[model samples]
Target: MAYDIKDVRTAMDPVDNQYHIVLIIILISLIIAAGISVLFTGGQGPGETLNLSGSLVEQDSTGQKEDPAETWIVRILWVDDQNRTYSFQDYPQDTKPDPKSYTFTGDPPPGAQAAMIRFLSWDGSTERTQGARYIMDPDSVTAVLNRYTLMARLSPLPTTTPVTTNTPAPSGTPIPGMLIPESGVVCRNADGSCTARFGYTSRHDHPVSLPVSDMNRFYPGEPDRGQPVVFMPGIHHDVFSVTYPGDATNLVWFLMDKQVSVGTVPRVNTSIMIEPISGYAPLEVRFSERSTGSVPNNPLAGTWNLGDGTITSITGPFYHRYEYPGRYTVSYTVSNACSQARDSGVVTVYQASYTWDTDPKNPATVRFSCTSTGDPSVWFWDFGDGYTSWEQNPVHTYQRAGTYQVGLTISGQHGKGSVVHTISVPS
Candidate 1:
């Protein structure tokens, strides 16, 4: 057949070819199916699933008993790196159902960083309602899911497109002796459901109360002391339903996953007292503890630093003698786990004793001098007459004295000392 090339090409056109049309339709359908699959997978590449599990608790019994129809609406909230939020709602098993445990599985959307499970309970008959929120740790969720088989052929589905969340509440400031929970979690199913385990807080480290108290004590007491508890890192979760007054349902859930760290220990509390701190060379001083902490069997050690280049570890009362006359700074330090405490005082040793010399011309006129070896800041002298002098040396005239009592008192940084002597004047 001698046919025109234009006619032959037109005869083979796709619109005219049934097989070509069928193939084209199949290609278009495949593209649509792929796009649908991505949406259902929450845009995850593949094989990544988030597993979460917890229990549902009834915080309010009064309202549930009054209106059997009082139902709970549970939802999960997911936040992305951009702070975009999405929610997935979960329907109750039935109109009215008993509280029980639940598990959630899904693939998280790309750029998802944080997720929270919110429990909101309301009396369908009235306007009264209450809610509680638990923040989840993604690493914790993964660890828990690793223990179980992921849901077969299941992917995260977004219920709502990305939207701006409320101005996020400020994160709680970290406190001393307290651990701060992880932040920024993303979820797969918007508000449907999410699961997480507290991996960082697992039983390995020592755990303490959130707001520590002096009255709080370690668990498993007596036998447990010294023997550390073995905590396996995995999903640890618990749900609590606390009955709050009024229609409000207050619920708080937590997993004791972390060990408590030691924070500022109790400060060392005590004082030091020294008696006869200063005296002539060969001065002996008595040192003792004035007080210490009220805690029993305290872990504190006591030591003394004698200003004269001597340090000693002593228990109970301590006595030390200074061989040379000099001024020394004495300090005592009480060492304990919490802190080190110290107290300081000065000690002075005198060089010479009290002495007086009579004038060559007049014996009645006597020159009184403090030959004491130590250095005294202040000196006082009483000639036994009605006279007093604040001088290291003073000359006194005895009017008609057969015998007179002379007294000298010295005061220094270390302590105070006094001496008395009898003087005779020729009549």
Candidate 2:
């Protein structure tokens, strides 16, 4: 039933041909209009236009000229109603130097839910990033972002829009039904053999030694944006939060790649030695400082307060002679960038006198008595007969008469003393 062209044309006539031509022209016009609509509107379906604008600036010493250079990069993320995320990056033009603010145009896809935006500082070798999240409003078309441009060295970026539609902005009180880091086996290694090895610098640049391998070791598996967990070695970093509905985990991002300080606080031990703890006038004493606890060396850099009103900026085994009989306190203080500590000791100086007598009843027997003028805290006697005694008075009987050298040493709160005498005995 296929008809030849000539037969078909004869049956149509001029009136039919003109009608078909008009229909063809109308169809072509409709197709062209649809293409134009898609080109201008990005083929969006039933949603408002999204206008995202922000500014980035390089850091200067004077806090002026906060604008990004031409080579910087910006990345933006958009989440649709289906929870599908779309990413746009490689926007070098947005970082033109010394220009007006940078802006992005987006057609909020039908059923769009949330959005996130971040800027990157790139030097063709390394990149620093700053990001913030927001709850997409189907009714609003404008979103604004403002924050410090540098990472780790500056403040966090701030967004004007809300992160969620139902939740009000954080006020004075905790929000109702707000989810926090969950508590379902935050760490692995059930046997408790795992050890904490890593540490990070906090926002204030203070080093926090982690008690575990990392914050994620407590988690059952890998970490995500929405897990309620507390930092170990106790909460030392800036609190940063992230929630990816796609992953369903709240990941904390406080390990902000900061420089950690090395070394430890310094500790010192002060020691004093006096030849005679109790003696006459003009007693000589020695003071020494020994570093006990430090990584490599002591961090203290302050002076030594001799406690006798003599402050010297010297780390010493220092010597001093006391001219008068009295009690003196010695101390040393050391300080460095990390911390400071002080150690002290005491020295006493006094007069001492002692004498011994022998028993005439038995020349081989000797009874020694301390007639010391100073009240000695302690007394020692060397009989020179192969015997020693700590008592103030001692009696010794020699097996045979012989020549002997007897010595007595005494110490008290004031000072120290020593006396030696020669004795002869006959059998």
Candidate 3:
């Protein structure tokens, strides 16, 4: 029977009191069991609670208040066997006028084999990692999460002290210290691109600001490539990166009188140059490999994907002919012990041909249609008479009717080709 809400309520109300109590008890038992399952299985899965406590002491205590605009970030990181990194970070604020210590908690991801802590300082635009420390293990997994303490002394923020001097400082008076440009690591990206990191070390007691000029610049390209103008006093790594397609090499950063080359690490750099990228069918295209790597005299094992169901392990400065007409993507890859690089280009093959349709009533007039491929930029049409036209598709009238040979010639960046057909014109 179909029961309404009132009917269902009445049916439920007829249950005995003891049965109602038993149902309530069963529901409570099920809820308690679920809670216990979650507490054991869900809560305890794949992570650990980390209690991080640290103290920061100023290198030069000036008895002055800390800059409100400045922020310090404490990061705890660990890597698993799969080379995946897990990080826990906290931003500590100054409670007092002069900040001293900080305390916070973090949850590190599972399989954390080794743990390290890094302290960073961020002042609006720039953020720099001051230093990093690896925690010594008492045991394997359990030692990473327990109560840990770190003590670090931070460098004083840059300040300008006024000096009373009546006479102007002599011209070319040497600056107090020097700024050395240093090249950091080269990182390979998943998209086959690479990045070279650059940084600087400031030996001065205070911060230095240099504009993008001859004193501070990058070589082989633009003078300014998003490098920092303001430098903090310390050895800061990876201040900026130069991202380019393929491997980076011979990139130099010029700071004052010092210069450093980036991407000094040994790796293969690949480039493909294809001449006459597009042409008529049975097109013979030239492919050249301009790849360079650190290993000199090392034979580069290269592979080419002709994109026409043809794959060859041929070292190029070679030729490949496309028998049919279509657009095909060509790729070349070169590899050695250091690393591998790959580049791709497109080759378009066009078939030179045309179709002509004559007017039914006016048999002397004809419309010539150019069906040639590859978007030919230049077209020449000869109507078998003395008249010629440059239009892709042209119409012509014959004064006298006879068998005539019409020709069409097309040309583009790919190359040039021509085709001719004999047609009978009626009188």
Best by lDDT: 3
For model 2, residues 1-427, the per-residue Cα lDDT tens digits are 7999999889879788899999999999999999998997665544333233532233456645543332444444333434322322223332332222445543433453224444555544434554333345422312211111111211112333322212111122222222112211111123422211232211211112322234333233344434223322111222332212223232232222212222222233334344444454567766666644343322346466655677787665667777765777776666543345576766666655455566778778788888765687798988887889998888888888889998988877655677788888788
Query: Model 1, range 88-185, lDDT digits (tens) per residue?
Result: 33333233222244333444555553254544444543222244344567565444323422122223354332322221211222224343222111
Candidate 3 per-residue lDDT over residues 294-389, each given as its tens digit: 443234688999899899887648888899989899998888634688999999888999999999989999999999876789999988888999
**Whole-model Cα lDDT per candidate?**
0.51, 0.47, 0.65
Candidate 1 residue runs with Cα over 4 Å from true position = 1-266, 294-298, 353-370, 373-427
Better of 2 and 3 by TM-score: 3
- The 10-residue segment with the lowest total lDDT in model 1: 239-248
Looking at model 2, residue 154 earns an lDDT score of 19
Model 3 misplaced stretches (Cα beyond 4 Å): 1-265, 294-298, 399-402, 412-415
Per-candidate TM-score against the hidden true structure: 0.27, 0.26, 0.35
RMSD (CA, Å), each prediction? 22.3, 21.3, 28.5
By TM-score, how accurate is candidate 1?
A: 0.27
